[model samples]
Target: MRLNIKSSILFALLVSASAINFSASVPDEGMFPLSELHKAGLKKAGLKISEKDIYNPGQIGLVDALVRVSGCSGSFVSPNGLIITNHHCAFSAVQLASSPLHNYLQNGFVANSYEQEIEARGLTIRITDSYEDVSKDILDAIAKTDDPIERIAIINKKKAQLVKEAESKDPSIKAEVSEMFIGKTYVLFKYKTIEDVRLVYIPRQDIGEFGGETDNWVWPRHTGDFSFLRAYVSPDGKPAKYSKDNVPYQPKKHLKVNPNGVEENDFVFILGYPGKTFRHRPAQYIEYQQKFLLPYTSELNDFQNQRMLEAGKNDKATELALATRIKRNANVMKNYRGKLKGLRNIDLIADKQKEDKALANFIQSNTALKAKYGTLMSDIDKHYQLVFTDAERELWFNNLYTGIRTYQIANLINKLKIETAKKGTLAQKNEYFNKNIALVKKELDAVYESYNVDADQKIAAHMFAQAYNLKDKNVIQTIANKNFKSADAAGSYIAQNIANSKLNTKEKLYNEVLNNAATLLAYDDEILKSQQQFAHEHAPFNQELTRREGVLNKLMGDYVAVKEIYQDKSFIPDANSTLRLTFGNIKGYSPADAVYMKPFTTVKGIIEKGNSGDIDFRYPQAIEQAWLDKNFGAYTLKGTNDVPVDMLYNMDTTGGNSGSPVMNAYGELIGVNFDRAYDATINDFAWNESYSRSIGVDIRYVLWIADKIDNAQFIIKEMGI
Candidate 1:
């Protein structure tokens, strides 16, 4: 039937509005697996390469170039196993390799040759070899178990067996079975682990961590958060521990870096292991976070960071030791603060409830769906209510145990008691004791290195004050009442205990505590007694919470299956530290009214933000001179002649995605994904395309630092530039 001109215009408007609404609602979502990229609408999203070009189990692809760098992501930039990742990803190694004289963390390091590369002890890199769907195998193994706990045990056993068989095939291969969509699907990932990793190059802290906490998660970022590491292997090309005889391992595929750099609206994609996200979680969870969890956590994190900073002041060794931990805590605190703000700004609970209502209406319209999925949302809400009820006590117990040294000592003592109770021969018992004693001593040494009695005491006092002020009936208040009249008195008592305790020193912990396990077990201390009482009081709540979580996971798994069936929509599983591909374009965002954040920031921003008095803003003299001289060399942008420091993209990312390779349409390395904008931290809970933007260190800035500042020509040549 033909329509009138006016009717046709109205119809066209309706269709256009519908399309815009759909686009706005969905955003550029999904952290798809390599095999599912095609189905994820990659081509329609402007992917110029085939899915196979990014990942192929049977052949070398972009996946081969990716590596899991400790807890972060990295990509091979050279055939000789040179990897590029965020400097913060390698921060621990840098700190470990630093000392009063060398101070790698402050000065950075540049290896002119392979021989000069410093060994990164305890660092390992893993490359994905293969992955396969193991959902049926896991489901079958747990099919007979109706109890959630028993089902988990059965699934874990099956997973262990699978990993054992896979690893037994090759000693160098590490295997893991990761559950996706709660438990609806499972995939076994096999990786070739290279243990001999070495630090190749790192820019100074002034460049690497520029602007520090002040500019973290903010736009117009100028941080050159990039570093290089090389993977080494034995003579026969097998993974081995650090050795003098080891050589740089050759990778099957390495990314060809495009030093020419990317412009705004350029197609960008990322392949890495994202840590976690709760985009599919029920509305109750969002409500709980908004009302309670995020604010409380942020407060605790702030307290802890302040204590650490106060303790580390004027002590270089202590500062170096606490640097990594302080950075982590500060990052988390900022993230929680951002998340809380974003949650309130977006009215996430109302939006989630609206979505839930629509889903419920759809289910109610169909008989089978009504019967199968009608109670899912309510069931989730019910479980969340229980969680909220026990959260206060749980928070108290967790904070006391985590922040107090005495509580940790109590745990160690209890572990030692359990070890002594085990049945074994005298020699075997002695062997176990010696082995465990070494471990205990190592742990005690680390604790002592970072621990400050005054700081811990202050933290303990704060915790007690919080519990007392809230009139919490938890063990914290009970202990406070028994030991002292007020939180200040409680703090003083804990401080005295910390100062007098033998556990304060490693030598005392070993010779006095470890060598006399029986004596330690029989000893009575106020801190230890308080820890025991706290654990006893919280045990039931902890057990119930675990059971509730298991049940909730199963329910969520069922809900996912039902939604997929009824809605006929693609259900990408929540991230669980597994490899996934997310694609988007370099784009700016409007964070607030009339405030447009451009996708890219140049070196000019760095200079503008620089302050010689602040360590974070201070640059090396060479870098300053080069910038003044306009020595961008080949790293300059074509028309503007400016070196891009960082760029923003709309790709989905999380914690572990730091250092992830930001690639062009053809899968060439262009940047490194490091941090997301502050307003986008809520992407973990819910994604709003207008606010969710991930930032990356532009490759051109990295090269500019290498060539113009550090004069690392050999490293540049090694990339075959």
Candidate 2:
């Protein structure tokens, strides 16, 4: 059994990141963790079932049906590990299995039998077994040191030890300790990881992504946005990697799909692993996002998207390979634009300022509070001031390392040289090479499989030009090793490096570069030499940022404590990729003075959009014909041939909530949550019921597509519909 070095490193880093955490929530603003569900007032808020039915400690319950499908949330809908999630969540797998001959991304996929299901490479699922609070242990360990860096080290070491102890009891478990609130609380979550996930059904792009970028975060959407998958385990009911001997995993519980979905004002809720939210941060943090982060990332993403488009022009294989990356970049670019708009539209910074001022006054009025929190706001402001000081320079170095493939490979080679030098004996060096050479080859193979040199060079040149525009000329001069009179000069230098470097092409990377790493390190290859220089210059700045984060963590924890006292309530912490419960009534909101968006969209909406001249709106002829023929079957809304396509609710959600099961009062699946309305994009900063509606494909629509259009009746029967 070989070690999975990549998985091990990722697990360690994630465990360490658990030290910093966020917010307090009112009932409506809360994505309440399962341990805190008792405070959510479920029955009082119209739950038809008991609380224990949703989460029963030491027993299987509705929460047992939930699973984390990669970054998104999903649920078991059948006794045999049949899982349902968003189409975009499974898009990469479909893209991987696709080709010009049988493009699954365009034509859709249906595995009529188990044998036909394609292996979903790099996609895995996790069922959370249990969680326990470990806040006291971590805080106590850190209390010995006031030095910020030392404190961070202590906390990380404590978390690692706890995870190791937990996993030692069971080899099948993957344990993680997540921060619930920065410097304040921590929880250890145990998950059963199944690596053999397969794609069972996925709709064509015309159906899954109808209206494409235009309707992505908009309301009254007609997109299906749903897909089906299956999870498999070893025959003896243990987690294992993909293999022929694996069988479908049988979960202790599964969700019951309700054909009769929700109506206006129906009670609804979601259970999912909602991603990060900054609702509790100080006003200065919001200022940082508004001023720099959002704009810079959005613009960079847009630039990359255009380069990809140009690279794939008239090349089918290139287009197929870049499909997923292009789609993901476009989605994020547009999402950030919306978030910027939403931040201004809601005046979020001004609102946060008002809250901060009120809290300040409250502290001044109480002698004890003043004593404890006198410098809290000031310290937080100071941290941001430091962040803003060198933000532009830091941004350049960060993106250079993260955004360039050649730079990454160069860094890895440099690392290998350092490690090899540490080995004092020939035998030890040989042992290292034997263990790692195969992994290096595997990584380089993947890089070449999707490599587009021309487009990437353009992107790299663009980034260099952008950095050269900074007001501080000395830093750029130091980095480039020369003074440039114009940004184009800087860009041209990097473009030349990328084009003429010895390791620019696959053959050169393997034979001249990877095979002779020591010679390249001792001598100077243009690309590797420049990358090493950048790494050397970046070391101090990165260290400073880490120290600042440690100090900020402690400051924010104090802020949380003081805010809790000021509000006189025990609040639900913000989401940090942990399982949580958020409930709200099915409703809609007005985005403008005269506009009132409806809560439900029907199949008629799909045809209306399809008739538009936009290619994104063009649907399959079969779908339009099915609508004209009134082929909605039993899935139609009562008293009409209309089938609800997508519905809106005000449930609090964020990025990782995609594919979370939307359940009715009785805890039966009613929909699959996918996106939030454009206005709700700002919810991550601050959420209010007025414009925080979430969108989901109604379950009736999911069933109708499987039964009437795709003819995947086996999925219908397996869901016990």
Candidate 3:
């Protein structure tokens, strides 16, 4: 029988089957905030530490040691601020410090002394110092706004004012306001930004990125994907940029390394910032992502990867420069592929549809709810359909500007025109021009460093062809119709213009355009004209998209409010790049029939997988000899002669959780979380116990390599191993 709202509403709402179950019997899921851990069933899951041991604003604890390094997570392993994180997390910094003669990326780096540590340009580490609820403040400020846009503006103004006030209280503090629980909650986080980060140690590509793309998200992996960095501060022990006078930062608390690696079903928890998730989104959104967004993104990424590969061949400089870009593109491509497959396998759309139907039925059966939320689902669905109608064109337009250099140049030109129109003194105008010109030069230099004219031309041609072939008329089609006989003709014309344009050279740009902004503004440039026209035509669609998003945000917040009031179930806020704690056991599962994956992988697997000539499988001769000789030190697991490489757990995690410290029940560091299993990629939308698993590099393997291969005994001694 269909459930009647009047008779069964409370019972049905009390038990949220879709949410993470807090019972000990269920697989551990949910990225919970540190403040919520005390009430989040941690004790039932065998936590050995108190709530204050994980986080206490008044005192230093585990959260204090956890630092936001670059865009990933890392933890201080020593009081002097020796940080341990994933090698991929430090890839860009290593690349920046590397050159043809001193290739730190190909060969590993180890600092024997503090002075040997190299400066990592443009790298920073952030530590959260305090947090407070600001929900009441924001809600009270926006209580009178009936219009969604006005409400958003008021909320933004209040948040900005709060952050500014908080930051003004102390020079060392950087403040940000975070919206949580679908905007039902607001929290202001204050961070101490340490800007002088340095590279301490990193393994060679062979060990750090051993499996490469072949085993990126696969299980039973042997990748030793961990690196060490050190944070530095000014002589007065304050945040500052990199300098020789800086000293290593002394953190109040750092994690103790536990060489005794985890065994099966052992309690494990991770504390770090998870990037983002969309688990609370409606069924229509999921359908759009699965059917349209992922497919489109996957195709574009695949094309970019191919172009980058072709451009990198036989060119060492280009190869080195494009390595990070190639890796990023390939990672996203693989992720989208996995997400697409997982969505189909899990039938998330159908499940969401069922849930939506139940929600609709309940609302319809109640007089008050029927009046308030009767049209909510239909409204959202209609807006989503309208947005999807122009999805292809919007995708093409956005990506074309980012992918092509000419479009970027055109944007700069447009910006200069705007700035020129402003009333200012002659000196002020020149100063503005000079500043903007310098920025343009920097951007152009970066573009030319990795830019391949031929590859870009091919990409532009393909993009034009796709855009022109679409049923709807877009700016690309209009441009082609106005200027050329076909898409190929237009592409060739644009490519030639990019090749011959004076903007290609920085000196020309400065002398010709910077000093003569008015003349250039009046000059005829096909690309600039097309871009301006495109922006003009695209404004209406962009505005509509923004309006729909605002409406959705308000409706979703109201839905969350209703659910919280009516349901007795606990709800953890979705991830939004904030520090969170997720606990689970060291266990494994079968991804397919007759295929059971063990919880841990060992160095023996690495030996078996190694091939002498292959880049991904090859290892150093000394490392292979040490493995063959069975030189397993105290870092080896108990009752086993082999060293553990990587392990899998059921902890909930996402993108920014990479390099997060995986600790035992005692709050001791045991491993570093890096990637998720291929089948678990869909966890961002829906986490399934049967398939979801997070992969971490065992800390023992890291020490083993540091001792045997790198002979970095100093680091080991510093960590008290």
Candidate 4:
């Protein structure tokens, strides 16, 4: 007999007999969990080394060498904790260490000794120590809660308890509860976090990002996108924050660099923390992304990029301060554009809709299946309708408050007021109030440290213009009341008001927050009033959206359960920024008919792009001279006289996989995974072996640059080349 929804919804939705079978056919998909490596058929897929070499759970393996550098991935290259990651991953550190007199971001940075290595502020690296399945604990705790919100609350409490229990065993360990399958499976991953990370090497901007945005996600790339950092610990070999007393950390395992890169069709694999993917989402979710999310986000990012460019055009300090933000936004903006194009090119939504229809038919054809999942399709569609109804208005209001600092401060103040007035126990209210108050102060500190009024005003103006042009202008009561004649007028009005506000500075706003909390909600600033109006208008929708998300989470879990039965296979869990391994071979694809792309690119391509006179393609002078002189070092391939710059493979990777080590069959580092082919940006939605090609900077290129251009032979020698 089947169980009722009230008793075992999550349990039934998760652990069917078929789902328990881990040994499914090894498809060219999935960011396989470390625990699942034995079943991943790595050996049959040309892994020359044993599976234990990659992930030996209780003992140290290559997995211990992997590091999550903030949001990107890296690998320890030496016993003393030398790390190799992408240049963009280390760009912020270089920016922090740069100035007009010593511009490391432009001229490059190289530490001659450990004493010279600069501290990388706010940079932390976490190594995965262990993970355990806690699905039964989480699912059983919430098994009886039928109310969606209450069920979610119970889940959170259970996850927190598990994490706290895990972290209790070691002070240096940081524990996280990752949802492997939404609302179904959970895992507790423990990490050893290193806080005293320092910058070791970074090439000049021209050499590091040779093609810039123009070639960011395209194939046949020629960017030497690599950098190095070192992790340090206290004298007693414990994790500690940056200090003069800290010594270099010595890891039990480190990846050995292979000077000779891969040949065509040689096997390669990446080990890193990959971010989110939505392959199993329903048709309506795909529709939402295709119709609303992707385009909207891309356009907003582009607008912000252009505004920042205009604000920093002449000021060198402003330019340097905004460089990281601009580069990050442009990267996302272009990636989203690629994803949107891929969606339309493949008609993903239409295909998903047809599949949904087929699933509904299959369910209806069987009495038992119909009784279990009769309203699944209709229920999912209903929730999506709620999401789509006010998405535009909500998106505009979200950007207004988040993109502009003044509005962000106003919103925080409003939140604090609400928190203060809430009816709760003294301890509860104090904890909540303190948290909100800290948030307000942090925002203030940030604004005081780096807020650019000109840039903020321009961004605010652009956002107001966007809001005014929306079909439902009443979503923002302030703009609606103004009745501006045109988008330009709307933009100019907001900018002028922001410029004239007395509470624009951090000191003034923070004073109000600290001294005048009782009357803070009624602050007289125009921007504050407008922000309150936006909050009032958006509150109902936000609440309903939360409830809808909870409901959909449960429904999607059930849908996947039934869908797996229908498909006769269990799908790989979507990536949730957990450490995973993906393997493929070194090969290329045909982006268009009659045009086959080669797997490898050489320094010749870099010089060719530089000759075009595009600043984005400019190479370093030493690179050009080295090419002209035919000064190929041992880093060059054995058979070919040319030195390799970048290579392509068919690996499954996403956002957080940046800077991951591209390892050859022997588990040696051969390249650094950075970008994906333009056609492969759709891999997040659906993976196609023919078109899903990932790009990485060849290790040979990194050695050549470190040896010939930057003269950092110490780094090469340290790698034991």
- lDDT tens readout by residue for model 2, 449-553: 555777778888888788677775226544456576777887787778878875567787667755543543353466777787787777876788789888998
Q: After superposition, how far is residue 673 of candidate 4 from its true place, in Å?
A: 0.3
Name the best candidate (by lDDT). 4
lDDT of 4 by residue, 356-391 (tens): 999999999989999989998999999888778777
In model 4, how large is the Cα lDDT of residue 199? Answer: 89
Which clashing pairs does model 1 show? none
Query: Relative to the true structure, how large is the alpha-carbon lDDT of every model?
Result: 0.78, 0.82, 0.79, 0.83
User: Which residue pairs collide, candidate 4?
Assistant: none
Regions of model 4 farther than 4 Å from truth: 1-19, 22-27, 412-442, 447-450, 472-474, 481-486, 502-524
Please give, for residues 141-244, the per-residue lDDT of candidate 1 as tens digits. Answer: 87776786677667779999999988998666898988776765677777888999999998989889998998898887999999999999999999999999
Model 2 segments more than 4 A misplaced: 1-27, 421-431, 446-450, 473-480, 516-524
For each candidate in turn, the TM-score is 0.91, 0.94, 0.92, 0.92
Tell me model 3's lDDT, rounded to 2 decimals: 0.79
Stretches > 4 Å off in candidate 1: 1-27, 421-431, 469-484, 516-524, 611-615
Point to the candidate with the largest TM-score: 2
Predicted structure 2: lDDT: 0.82
- How many clashing residue pairs appear in each of the predictions shown? 0, 1, 0, 0
Candidate 4 lDDT at 681 equals: 87
| CA deviation > 4 Å runs, candidate 3 | 1-26, 421-428, 439-450, 473-485, 504-524, 564-567, 612-614
